[model samples]
Target: MNKKILIVEDNKTLAKLIAKKLQSALGLTVDVAYSMAEAKLFIARYTYFIALLDINLPDAPNGEIVDFVTEKNIRTIILSGNIDKEFRKKILKKNIIDYVNKSGVDDINYIIHAIQRLQNNAKHKVLVVDDSRVFRKQMQTMLENLFFQVISVAHGEEAIGMLKSQPDISLVLTDYNMPVMDGLELVIEIRKTYTKNELCILVLSSNEDEEITALFLKHGANDYVKKPFSKEEFSCRINNSIEALENIQMITNYANRDYLTGLYNRRYFFDTINEYIDEVKNSGEKFAIAMIDIDHFKNINDTYGHDTGDKIIIALADILRSSTNPHDIVARFGGEEFCVVLKNINQYSAEEIFNRLREEVEKFSYHLKDDKYINFTVSIGATLFNEEESLEENINAADMLLYNAKKNGRNQVVFQA
Candidate 1:
């Protein structure tokens, strides 16, 4: 949620600096309070994402502000000039996110980083697996406080089923001691579907044995956390794993996607289509392959320059994307050309679908730099896949039909039934 963060500090200078830093860095609305009274007023007036509370306020001394804020069920971060270990431990015992020593700019930087982490955590969903209801609830509470969408399961078998249903899960936090199946077995099973870079698996257990850690890691666990983990440790590990996963996926996308169109590149398209063919070879699922190219694309590039040509390409990609089913494969085969697989469809229906797509393209307009609009059209050639033919052979037939469409006339769909 894009919400406000409340800063309750008795130091006006420090509070304003924190507010400014937070506002500039995160682009979030921040309210600064000079004392506990002012903080209470802000809290009653507005709901905050999280509250940053100073330990010793002008009116409420001895870190009483922490108690008041936490009692209100607000997630808090304690800011104190005091750095005594015993005092820090006592303050952290409360439900505050972290105890920050207000030493200087570094402490302010820490707050910024923590807020950014929490914001990024919102885009991720974490699965919590534990046989014990108490532990499950505990992990769920912690994960939610850290801004994750959490789904907790009692054991490995249920976790597997949940993962199947929720394929978008980013990470799994599983406990080793569980019924139905253990964490190690869960790790092995999950790895069959998702790779280490695609999904992260973290094992949590009371067993501090080194062998258990090795066993989990060897079996595909990304990392291991012992029982009674401090909030900081847990947060760091979880965020690190997710960060790594995102980085890897980003790199993979760059490799497998067309940079300009954001569609599957030719290499990935063929690879995916080949896998689909293998899956449906025995099932007799009908599909159609289509080759599409813009009408007179090179002439447009010559008249308007390649920059405008790129814009036209991107616009056509959007049309193709919105016009197709989610399960359908749409890829940018190359410059000014694309490919699509109409899955679970007959020849007649596929022809109708492509004709509608062609109509949508014909009726579309791209506004030019001179306040004028330019209209473009495309020619599509489609054919039903023949089980007797190889993937390359079927594609070649579609390509020949595309040539015929270009030869006969552009801006139309040609289907070879």
Candidate 2:
């Protein structure tokens, strides 16, 4: 399909000429609007891939038209006769893709090149949550010009559903003050379910006061942009916020990873288990937990020193990690202790996995610094989590089963009744 371009220009001759050139050169179908009102009407009536806009129009001056176009999710190139350097600088700050002063044929050609560039660049996906339709539309425009797929919701509830539907959303721009659920409340709810890396949030505020900014940041917002914000400045802040989120996520993944096992650490394990419980609670799906302990670990530690014990632990972790499927949650619970939480599996399958792990652990060998080969074994206890059971109860049941394995001669697997 040929790209649609809306030309918001008061000069009929210029508008027609630009439209002709764009249609002839770029194979674009152009729509002309002599005023902001007509432009808005055209916008509501049809979807334009891009908008060629003049900062000043008869109905609304001072780039209000640009703001309107931006809200509509239309990529815009400012085509204006206005020569105020300060004003142009201000619009550039708002993240409008490009600004071209009213010029000759060459400038129009440059504008077409800019539009082509916008089409070729990567498209960011933004979810805008705001009670105000006005605000949502504004962000939609700015984002579209930068080649972003934009989804806007008028309230927090709708925003949540939208986020659930589009899991790949790159960022969310939400208003601080709104009906039903406000921005801070929304952020809190989202954080409770999703990781900080999974979603990047920015609070929009009419008030740019330090207290207000600090309050939103405290509530887990990535950043804040004041209302009546300069376009260029808002763009810079959003880009920086995304970069910061990527860095933070990288650090978080490393910090929550076990050094020896390459599995999740105790902290990440706990966090993930809780999240799993939350997910299963709503679905009533059956899950299993297993507690594993290296049998006679203390004797090994005393006989070969702590270094040998450490090598054995690392080797055991590697065995368990390689034995389990990707869906399985294997973690070094602590010391010689480890745990696995299997989802969508019943007690029988859990016991089978437990037996397999026991056999693997028994067969595994480790090497000490003196190049001496050492063999070790592990005991495991498994339990099925009931819908009514707490995580602690589930853990206790698994631990008790592990104790039974140790009691019934080590290197065995036991299941809770």
Error of 2 at 179 (Å): 17
lDDT of 2 at 329: 92
Can you write out model 1's per-residue Cα lDDT over 332-371, one digit (the tens) per residue?
A: 9999999999999998899999999999999999998779
Global lDDT of each candidate: 0.91, 0.81
Candidate 2 residues lying further than 4 Å off, grouped into runs, are 1-162, 166-170, 173-198, 202-221, 224-236, 243-284, 299-305, 325-328, 367-372, 386-394
- Model 2 residue 47 lDDT? 90
Q: Pick out the ten consecutive residues of candidate 1 with the lowest summed lDDT.
A: 90-99
Candidate whose TM-score is highest: 1
TM-scores, all models, native as reference: 0.92, 0.48
